[model samples]
Target: MLPRVVRFDLLFVRTDYSDDDAWRDALAAATAVHPSNDFERCGAALQPVESPELSGLTSAQLVGLPRADYLAELAVADAQTMRDQTVLFVDLNELNKQVGRTFRAIPSQVEPIVANFSIANMDFHEFADNADPDGVFRGFTR
Candidate 1:
């Protein structure tokens, strides 16, 4: 079967109980149960002004670019100070198969795993004909 690639926007914020080990453990547990293919990339957060410059580019232009391109550009532009944020990109075809649902339908299943870490916010963006332009599913916590 063809792989169904999906992009997940994970926001890991620091908490009193949060540490690198805790974050790793949560991600490791999730991957053990729902093994994913290679992580496309991971990087620090990107600033808002950099969004247009990055997202507006065509797929061809985006290809071969480093994952931290936007973050680097933000540093050069000096729009605002960077924050302590970590973002990850992983393809969830295996997880989707295990859950017997598309990425859009499995947010509930994945929420528990994310909750194990110190996640300030999380969102899953599924590109489909019927999905919203912003995102199909999103969850936020303060």
Candidate 2:
């Protein structure tokens, strides 16, 4: 059986606007709302950050680019890790607090063994689809 995955969205309560009413009441108040989009339950594979340089970018710079592609890259990377069983668990408890505020953090984890100031943004789905599929994926998908 596949391990259950959960989608989490949190409101810092410090931001100017919180969509707490929408997501909170719509989904049982378990998720939080910020200026960004909703959070979904991604698989273990979705947790790893493949491009250190890309992942290391500031949220402002990333937002300037095509966010959909970038998110796709994260989705693909995460899916692969789930398949490999080498998934890394990034502690998002603190990072969750930073979203609407300043959004600061470095990726600190043990499994893949990498450390860097990073932010988790899965909004690059478009970039991910356009990347070298072979390297990102063991087998190219149609």
Candidate 3:
């Protein structure tokens, strides 16, 4: 499920298959890789962008803070989207690609919803936990 949820965050292949069978076949090929004999069937939920659950908080706090806490914070207007304005980037597809594996796109994975890039939230504290103390931008944790 995480793979399906994170795949878009990981790659931009093509999720717009007009055919369901085509989509499944493509999904299989996309996930097949070194150490991975095949793709596993699993269930995942799609939270609508406008849905009550995903409506409020900025993109940042959604991950930096816990779901309940952030949801509560989001209930109030003018709330901080995150603990801070810190910015960071994590390449979600690196692990697979390192082994010469490719990533997949999620067009039909969900409706084509556009996120507000104008908003973002972050907690440097959360990011620091797994950050490379050596102060390099190369990569982290392989």
Query: Considering lDDT, where higher is better, how would the candidates rank from best to worst?
Result: 1, 3, 2
Error of 1 at 95 (Å): 24
TM-scores vs. true structure, each candidate: 0.19, 0.19, 0.19
Clashing pairs in 3: 15-107, 15-108, 60-121
lDDT of 3: 0.25
Q: What's the lDDT of the predicted structure labeled candidate 2? A: 0.23
Error of 3 at 128 (Å): 31
Q: Please state the error at residue 77 of candidate 2 in Å.
A: 15
Model 2: worst 10 consecutive residues (lDDT sum): 105-114
Each model's RMSD to truth, in Å?
14.9, 17.1, 15.8
| Residue-wise C-alpha lDDT for candidate 3, range 79-136, written one tens digit per residue | 1112211122222222223212111122221111112110223322223344455322
Better of 1 and 2 by lDDT: 1
lDDT by residue for model 2 (1-142), tens:
1112223212111111123243223222112122213223321122222233443333334323333221211111122232332221222223333221221111111111111112333322222233342323111223
Q: List candidate 3 segments past 4 Å from native.
A: 1-14, 34-142
lDDT to native, each model: 0.26, 0.23, 0.25
